[model samples]
Target: MTSAPLAGCILAGGLARRMGGGDKTLLPLSGAPMLARVISRLQPQVGAVVLNANGDAGRFSRFGLPVVADPIEGFAGPLAGVLAGLRWARAHHGEAEGVISVAGDTPFYPADLAARLMEARGPDAGRIVLAKSDGHMHPVFGYWPVSVADSLERFLREGTTRKVLAFVNLHPNTAADFTPEAGAPDPFFNINTPEDLEAAEARARIEA
Candidate 1:
């Protein structure tokens, strides 16, 4: 089934407590900021891409993409970031059918990530598509229908669990499986600590 064009968002709204309370996406991996690597992979895959982050937006001015903060106060987790992207896309890119979300700290996600999710969703405008790898579900890496923006807003306002999977399961959804290559780590592997950064460099040497 033909898929509609999508708007993309890198979810960087986390407080990054695991990495010592700073913008983890701005940290360097292989001599480049981690967010730059994510942007390089996602930019070509969607119609428009934005950074969903909190705090001073000026820090991300060099990226030159629109920076959207969580609509709800406090660090509301990935679901809030997804909602921000959905609302932004609905407002700015009316031609887009949905929003594709990715973790900002994950640099090596598949280049065809958005394409696969859109295909899994088929022509169904309301279906959510999530990516899975090695029996683990990556809820944040998903395709969300823009039409459900209202539903999500209510979900957040109600202040139940802020878990992404809980909300995604409430809607019709499909998972696209991604198998890891031999000797390579899962593409969704993200950096959340100094050791993870070291590990990413090690993998980059083999994969890059």
Candidate 2:
């Protein structure tokens, strides 16, 4: 657990353009929906989990989590999803001091994600901590403080660029390095295409 309570947010709003446009997270991974694997990894690390998605929330009903859409419309990018998650945590998970945002298609995220993020924080109360693997920062797998809800909303509503790093860079932020286990892929490896999914399965097989 974090020194402060935390909520989990799975960002699933991407259009999956490279994969022919659809919910890529719902696609199969090792005989089960990829998102099911995501939930399993993240659920243990936070107080509660919410799905950040857009359109037809009913499609995710089976997951039995509150589905929140980006507060700003027009597929405002992962930053919007992060903003939505922060607002939702502030409103519903009021006890949560922050929210952890994970990319829904990235099923291999580290199991100790939340704990490492908390460790990466400075003495401040609301530092943003992102995951780093092999020197690359995965901003989508981030810890966002509920206190940044208003600033994030303003960033989405007011800024022309919607990149997650743009806003994250504006604040106190650091990355928690994750060393790949022997025979394992980078923890933040995500499936974005048919070939990528095949590669993921092959990698999973190697690890198994």
Candidate 3:
């Protein structure tokens, strides 16, 4: 079945503590900024793409797309990024039924991700859809309904300290199972530290 079209969001507003204080999205991986590769992969799948980055949007202007900041402060993690994307989608692409978010540090995401995720959403509204691989769940790569703005806002205002999975557990979430291509490593690998960046480069070379 054909899935509903989605708005793609690259969650690039993190502090990058593990990779030093710089923006991990701008870091090079396999000769391309990690953010660029993510855009290239998602652009074809979604109706439109936006960067959810904070502080000085000019840095991402070269990408020639809208960059939005979290409505809440104190860097509330990926959930805040998700909220920003949902807000953008609602304002710009209100007709879009949902938004798909991927961390900027993850460049090797699956090609069929949007379809798989939208499929998992089923008939539910405000449902979260996450990807699972090798018995581990990658909550950062998922689809969320645009209607979540109010709940997310309330969570932020209430000073909720729950992690992404904990917040997700509060709602019904469908886990999409994806088997790695024969001999291919997991596609949702994320770069967090210097060692992870090196590993991603090597993996990219092998996949290329």
List TM-score per model, in order: 0.96, 0.94, 0.92
Instruction: Give a tens-digit lDDT track for model 2, residues 82-188.
Output: 88888888888789989989999998888889988888885666899998877788889888988888998898888989888889889988888897877666788
Q: Name the regions of candidate 3 deviating beyond 4 angstroms.
A: 181-183
TM-score of candidate 2 on Cα atoms, chains taken together = 0.94
lDDT of 1 by residue, 39-131 (tens): 999988998998999889999999999999999888788999999999999899999899999999999999999889987888788999999
lDDT per residue as tens, model 3, 1-208? 1357579889998788988788999988888788888998898889999899999999988789899998888778888999999999999998777889998888989888888888778878578899888778988899888987778778777854747887787777889887686877778888889999999988889878
TM-score of 1: 0.96
Task: Tell me the deviation in Å of residue 96 in model 3.
Answer: 1.1
lDDT of 1 at 102: 97
Clashes of each: 0, 0, 0
The better-scoring model by TM-score among 2 and 3 is 2
